[model samples]
Target chain A: GQQVMQIPQYQHVQEGEDFTTYCNSSTTLSNIQWYKQRPGGHPVFLIQLVKSGEVKKQKRLTFQFGEAKKNSSLHITATQTTDVGTYFCAGYTGKLIFGQGTTLQVKP
Target chain B: EAGVTQSPTHLIKTRGQQVTLRCSPISGHTSVYWYQQALGLGLQFLLWYDEGEERNRGNFPPRFSGRQFPNYSSELNVNALELEDSALYLCASSDGTSDVKNIQYFGAGTRLSVL
Candidate 1:
């Protein structure tokens, strides 16, 4: 069985602070995807990284995939009140396996 | 184009009962996936259906089963449900093509409560 673990299950940061969540997989992944879910909402696809040691950015959010393809991280710069949500990293081997997710709370 | 659509936005059942949740993927999407999300928890993979066939399943009991229709729509059935079965059931769909990267689009999900 393959497993994906995420760190800092819960994070609370001030409005102007930066936040980062790490994800590690028990086995190498074919690809990794990031998602965000608002309170009482379903998960929404964000981005996918297929190349090793790849980094992608969307506005103030940065996503990086490890060179070994077993780890990934998502960093949000200068968090805003609208950024409050649960961030999840999913790894794909034969099928998709989701991490427990990191809930981010941005204080205004 | 519409996103994935799930039925009966909410359901309430008691222990030992059976429940069925339905999902219609976005047109032209051939893969449907089921996941369970408990209160304050992450998404747990349940089942995957493609081309009206059972493709892959998670570590769930036989009590959890499902099927895909010719239209690529799917139904998830849970029999002999227990209190622990209460959770939000999310249905997602992806284009099962070689060129596509298998990015899943999710439905609003069906909230199930078993007493």
Candidate 2:
């Protein structure tokens, strides 16, 4: 059974601060996907990483996949109130094994 | 290109009652996945349906069951619901055309409140 473990269950950051969340999987993964769920909203796909050591950036957000494909990280720069949400890392095999997620609270 | 769609934005049920949730995948998508997100908890995998077949399920009890339709839609049935069943049930879909990587597109989940 594959499981994804996320670090820092909750985080409160001041505006303009940086935030980072890490995810580690119990088994090797074929790909890793990141999602964000805003309050009262569904989980929205952010990005997907398939190659080992792959790095992708979206504006102030950066995503990285471990060389082993068993870990991933999401980093947000210059946090804003609009960035408030729970970030999830899902490992994809035939199905998805989602991490517990890291809830980010940005303080204005 | 429509995203995944789920029915009944919210639902209310009582103990010993039964509930059904419906989900329609995006056009051309053939895989549907159901997940339960309890308050302050993570998304717990409920079931996976591909090509109108029950492909896999999670650690949930037998009371939690579902089936896929011929058109790639899905219905999740929960029998003898308990108070702990109160959670947000999310339905996601992916293109099952030998892509190998499952990049899921989620729908606005149905919030089920079991009393």
Candidate 3:
């Protein structure tokens, strides 16, 4: 059985600060996906990292996959109040296994 | 383009009752997956249906079962529900195969409350 763990179960940051959440998997992942869930909304796909040691960016959000493909990280620069939500990393096997999300709260 | 859609946004049932949750995948998508998310917990894989066949399932009891329809729509049925079954059920779909990487589009979950 594979297990994915996320760090910083919760985070409170002032607006304009940077935030990073890490995810580690007990087994090697074929690929990894990142999702964002706003309060009261369903999970939304943010990005997918396939190649090992891959790095992708979406405006202010950056996603990276470890060289071993056993971990991933999502970094948000200059966090905004609108960025308040939970970030989840899902590792792919025959199916996707989601990590316990990191809840981020940005203060104005 | 239509995203994943689920029926009965919220449902309430009692222990030992049966509940059915429905999900419609995105157009032309062949892979559908079901997951359960208890409050404050991560998403747990429930079942994977592709091409109208049960491809994979997680470590859940057989009480949790589902089917894929001809149109690629799916239904999750929880029999003899328990208070522990109270959680949100989510459905997702992708155009790729079950293994490896594929972008999954999710549906707004069905909140199941068992008393």
Candidate 4:
């Protein structure tokens, strides 16, 4: 069975501070996807990584995939109150396996 | 294009009762996945359906079952519900093609409360 583990189940940061969440998988993954869920809202797709040691940036957010394809990380620069939500990392083996998720709380 | 849609935004049931949750995937998508999210918890995989066939399922009992229609709509049925069954059931759909890396789009989800 494949499993994805996420660290820092909860995080609270002041505005303008940086935040990062790490994800690791029990088995090598073909691809990894990141999603964000706002309070009382559904999970929304953010980005995906396929190649090993790949790094992609979306505005102030940066995503990185490990060289082994078994780990990933999401970093937010200059946090804002609008950044408060739960972030999830899902790995694709034969099927998609979701990490426990890291909930972020940004203080104004 | 429309995103995944789920029916019965909220449902209330008692223990031992059976409940059915419905989902309609985005047009042209062939895969649908179901997950349970408890309060302040992560998404727990339940079932996956593609091309009107059962593709995969998570570590859940037989009481959790579902089917996909020819049109790609899906239904998840939970029988003999327990208090722990109270959670938000989310429905997500993917293109079911390898090229897209199976990127999924999720619906708002149906909240079920078991008494």
Q: Give Cα-based local distance difference scores for all models.
A: 0.94, 0.93, 0.93, 0.95
Across residues A12-79, which tens digit of lDDT does each residue of candidate 1 receive?
A: 99999999999999999989999999999999999999989999999999999999999999999999
lDDT of 3 by residue, B1-115 (tens): 9999999899999999999999999999999999998887777889999999999998999999999999999999999999999999999999986455377899999999999
Grade the docking of candidate 3.
medium
- Over 4 Å off, model 4: B97-99
Q: For residues B9-64, write the lDDT of model 4, one tens digit per residue.
A: 99999999999999999999999999999999999999999999998888899999
Ranking by TM-score: 4, 2, 1, 3
What are the clashing pairs of model 3? Answer: none
Q: Which of 2 and 3 is the better model by DockQ?
A: 3
i-RMS values of the candidates, in order? 2.1, 1.9, 2.0, 1.5
Q: Which stretches of candidate 1 lie over 4 Å from their true place?
A: B97-100
lDDT of 4 by residue, A9-100 (tens): 99999999999999999999999999999999999999999999999999999999999999999999999999999999999987888999
| lDDT of candidate 1 over B1-115, digit per residue (tens) | 8999999899999999999999999999999999999999989999999898888888899999999999999999999999999999999999963423688899999999999
Let me know the TM-score candidate 2 reaches against the reference structure: 0.97
Across residues A1-108, which tens digit of lDDT does each residue of candidate 2 receive?
A: 777999999999999999999999998888899999998888999999999999999999999999999999999999999999999999887678899999999999
Instruction: In candidate 4, list every pair of residues with a backbone clash.
Output: none
Taking the tens digit of each residue's C-alpha lDDT, what string does model 2 give over B10-103?
A: 9999999999999999998999999999987889999999998888999999999999999999999999999999999999998873425478
| Each model's fraction of native contacts | 0.59, 0.66, 0.75, 0.66
In candidate 1 the C-alpha lDDT for residue A62 amounts to 98
Model 2 chain B: lowest-lDDT 10 consecutive positions: B95-104
lDDT at A8, model 4: 90
Name the weakest run of 10 consecutive residues (lDDT summed) in model 4 chain A.
Answer: A90-99
